[model samples]
Target: MKATPITLLVCALGGEGGGVLTEWLVEAARLAGFPAQATSIPGVAQRTGATTYYIELFPVLQSQLCGRQPVFSLSPVPGALDALVSSELLETARQIGNGMTSPERTRVLTSSARLLTTQERMQMSDGRRDPAELLKLVRAFSREHQVFDMNAVARECGTVVSAVLLGAIAGSGLFPIERRFYEEAVRGGVPHEKANASAQASLRGFAKAFEIVSQRQTQADFVSQVLKAQAMDSRLRGNDAGADGNDGRATALSVIPAEAGIHGFPPPVREFASLGYVRLADYQGRSYADLYTRRLRQVLDAETAADPQAANGHAITRETARWLALWMAFDDIVRVADLKSRASRHDRVLREVKAGEDDLVKVFDHFKPGVPEFAALLPSSLAQKLVAWDRRRIAAGKEPWAMPLKIGTHTAAGMLALRTLAAMKALRPRGSRFAFEQKMIERWLDGVVQGTKRGWALGHEVAHCGRLIKGYGATNERGKDNLLHVLDHLAVLPETEAATHAIAEARAAALADDAGQALDATLVRHGAPKREPKPQPIRFMRRPVPRESMDERRA
Candidate 1:
C-alpha cells in the first residue's frame, strides 16, 4: 500500500521569506529520512502580488528501502491542500477564494495584520475594505485557523518571520516530526546566521501558535472572557458615563491635551473630537472650532433624548463627535498650502525620499488654479473679478493658469506663502467655499437629528452618512449629492416604518462605488429619477474641427 504525502502551501509578502520557510520544512522532512520536495512561485510585493511556497513530504522508510515513490504537485491544487500558512490575513483569504482551502481538509495559520491595499489608500474617500469582513470569511472557510501577530513575534525573536512560520508548522502536530527537526533545519540547513538565535525564533513561534490552538479547545468561553476583560480595562481607563457623568453608558475615550482648544465637551468626548478641532482650527481658526461645537451640541441634544441608554451612558454622543469635527473641517486650497509648508512635512519628504542629512532634496508641487482656488483667497468683490477673468480664459480656449512651486519650506519666501494661507484660516468662513461646505454640513446634521428622533438604527445610518462627505472639490460635491439623495429620496419614510433598512442600504451603496453608480441604482429602485452627471468645464484642446471637409463646408 502507498502512503499519502503531506502537502502545505504557504503565502507571504516578498520580504517575509516564504521561500526560506518552505526550505526549512523540506529540510525538516529530509532530516527525518523522509523524501520531501519544495517549490515556490514568487511575485511582486504588497497587494500587487504574493509569493506562495508548496511542500510535499512522502513516507520515510518506504521511500528509502521499498522502492515506492510519490508524485507531488509543483503548485497547489484547490481543495487538495492539507495546510495553508499565510503571513497576511487578506492573503489567507485570497487563497481560500481561489479554492485552495476546504472546510473539510485545510488548516489555516495566518497573521491578523493588514498592510492597506492601493485601493484602500485612495485620497477621495474611505476606500478601505472592512477588516472585520475579511476576518469573518477567514473563520467561515478554514476547517481550523489560528491567527496572531506573527510579525511582532519575529521582531522580538531577533529573526525573520520565516523562522516563526517553520515553528508554527512544527508545533501544529500536523506531522509526527519532533520540535528538533525544525531546530536542526534552522541551525544546520540555513547558512549565514548564528544557529542558536535562528533556532530560538523558530521555537518561540512554534510554541506560541501551539499554545493558541490548545486554548481554542475552550475557544468560545475563552473569547468571551477576553472580550469582557478588555471592556473592563477600557472602562477603568476611559470610563463611559451618562451626560450627568453618573451612569456608565460608555467606556473611557481617548483624550486630547487641554491646550488644543478641544473644549466645550467633557474630556471623554473632547479627546475624540480634538483631531477635527485641530484640523478645522488649522484650516480656519478658533471661531470655526466654535461653529463645530455648536453643531456637535445639536447632535448631543438629540442623542441625549433619543438614546435609550443615554440617561446612563454617552456612546451615541461620543460616536457622533468625531464626525461633526471632520465635516466642519472641510478641505480647501488654504489647507493644502498649510500642510505642504509644515516642517514635519518637509522632514517626512526627506525621510521618504531617503535623502541623507547633508543631501539636498528639491520638491515641486504642481498646482492648477481655476476660479475656485484663486477666488477663495480673494475678498468677495475681488473674487468675482478673478472668476470673471477665469471665465474669459476658458471662453478663449485657454487652459487655467498653473504654478509649479519648488518647496521652499526652509526659506523665508516659501514659508511665507504657506503661512499666509494658514493665516487665511481666519477668513475661511467669509469665503464662498467655506459657506457652501458649512451649509451642506448644517443640512446633513438636521437629517441626523430627525433620524435620532425616529430610532437608534436610523440615527446610526444617518451618522454613517458622514462617510460620504469627504475630500475636496468634485469628490466632496459628489459625496454631498449622494448624501442628499438618501436624505431626500430614500429616507423620507413614514414615522411608523423602519427607515433604517433603506438608509443603511443607501449609505453602503454610496461607499461601494467612487462614481456613485451604486448609489444612483439604490435611489432609482426607491423611485428616484436617473441622475445626470454634471457636465465638465470645457478644456483648451478641440477636435481639430475635422479638417473642414470642403464639400460639406460648401454645402
Candidate 2:
C-alpha cells in the first residue's frame, strides 16, 4: 500500500509539555520508518518568554526511490494537515485559523476548556470556562472529533495530561506507527511506569471512542487517505525531480543582516542573495576585503538603479562610479609589499603618541622622507622637524625655500595606517595578489565607518556600554542607584582606566557598607563597646629650676 503524509499539530501553553508531545511524535514517526520534518517557534514573542511548537510528519512508501526531499515548516501549504492534536481548546481555534488543519481531512483531539481565559483573568483573576463548551467548538470545525477528560484520566493514572494527550493522538489512527512506538515514547519521556500506564489507559480510551465514531461513518477516512496519498506522491516526485536535476531543490538561505552582529554595512539584495546561507558562518572571520566586496556589490546595484547616464544608461551614477574606481586604484597601491604593515606601524605610532609616548617621533622621522609631500604637511612634531631641516638647507644656500605640503590629522593618519595593516594581513597567501586587489576594490566600494551627527554610531562599543549602564538602572531601583553613583564617578576618569578603577571603588564601597552594617547589627545584638577616656600625658617643669640654679652660680 502507498504511504501517506500527515501533519500533526500539538498546541499548549509554552511550559505545558507541548514540546514533549511533538518530540514523542517525531520519535514515533522515525521508528515507524516514516520520513518526517519538524519545526517550532520555541519561545514567546521572539525573545520574550514561552512559545508553542508545531510538528509535521510524512510517511514514505517502500517502493519509492531514495533521494533528497524538501523540508517544510508547519504552515508550508494550506489545508495539508491530517490531524490536529491540541492540549487546549483555544489553541485548536488558533490552529484552524492559521491553516494548520482542514475540516474534511483533519482529526481534532482536544481537551475541554479548563485553562484560564484572558477575560477571566482580567475580571476574576481565576476564571475558567466549561470544558464542554470548548469541545463543542472543536466539533463544529472537525468532522472527526474525539473529546475526552484526559486531565482526569491523567490524575487517575498518576501522571500529567500531556502524556495522555500524546496517547490520544497516537490512538487517532492518523500515523502509520505501531502501538509499540507510542509505548516506547511514553517510557522514554515519562520515565516512571505509572506515567506510562496513564498514557496507555488514555490510548485505550481514545481507541474505544474512535471505534464508536468510526462505526457512525462520521470519520472522513476516505478524504484523509486520498489527501495523504497525494501528498506522499508529490514528495516522491519532487525528490525524483531534484535527483534528475530537472527541478531545483529548495534553497535554504540563511540571512545574517548587518544588524545581526555583522560588522559591515548592509549589502544589496542581489549580493546578499549570492552569498546566501552557505557563508553565514564565515561572516565573523571574513577578511575586510571580502566583506567590502560583498558590501560594494550591494552599493553598486543601488547606485546603478538610481543613476540615469551610464553606459547602460541606467548603470551606476558617474560620481559613484568614479569614486569606486578611484578607491580600487588606491587599494591597488595600498596592497603593495609591506604597505599594510607600514600603515599599521604608523597607526601604532600614533596610538603610542596618544598614550603619551614620545618615541613615535623617531619612527615618524624614519618614514618621513618616503612619505608623499602632501602627507609631509602636518602639525605633527615631525612636520616641525621637516621645517627646521628646510630652514637649515636654505641657510646653507642649498635650497631657497621649503616646498608646500599637505598632511592629514593625527586621527586620519592613524586610520590610514590601520588600513595598511589590514591590507598586509590579506597578502599573506601566496598567488593572491589579484584576489587581494579585487577585495580592496570591494572594500573601497563600501563607505567609510563614521559616527552619526549625534556622535552615536551603529555597533559602537560606547553605545552598547551606555545601553548596558542604562539597563542596569532599570533592573533594580535602589541597588542600581548606588551603582549609578559609582559609575558617574568612574565616568569622569579616562575611558581606558575607568573600567578597572571604577569597579574596584564600587566593590570597596559596597564591602565597606556591608561591614559597617554588620558591625551595627553586632552592636545592636551584644551592646556597644564600653566607653573610656584616654589618659593625658604629664608635662615636665624641671627645666626652669635647673636654669635658675645655673644663673645664680654664675652670678
Q: Can you write out model 1's per-residue Cα lDDT over 1-555, one digit (the tens) per residue?
A: 237878888888877777777777877787777787888887776577798888887755544657867787788789988889888888888888999988888888888877777867873456667778888887888888788877767655555677767766775666667766767776775552555654655666656655664466357457778878867876887855343455633576754666455466665567666766676666666777767777778877787778745553555556677777777766677777878888889876765554644777767665555577867756677888887888777777787665544555666776787788677776776787666667788888888888888876677678778878777777777888888877886667785254677777777877777777887787777666656777556665545656568568988
lDDT of 2: 0.47
Give each model's clash number. Answer: 6, 7
Reference-based TM-score of each model: 0.64, 0.34
For model 2, the superposed segments whose C-alpha errors exceed 4 Å read: 1-4, 43-50, 61-64, 67-71, 74-78, 124-133, 189-555
Off by over 4 Å in 1: 1-5, 13-17, 20-34, 41-49, 58-82, 97-106, 115-128, 140-144, 149-293, 307-319, 337-371, 406-432, 450-461, 481-555
What C-alpha lDDT values do all the predictions have? 0.73, 0.47
Give the RMSD in angstroms, all C-alphas superposed, for model 2.
31.3
Per-residue alpha-carbon lDDT of model 2 for 100-175, expressed as tens digits? 6667877788765355555554431124555556566677667577765555555444445567676676666677
Residue 347 miss distance in model 2 (angstroms): 75
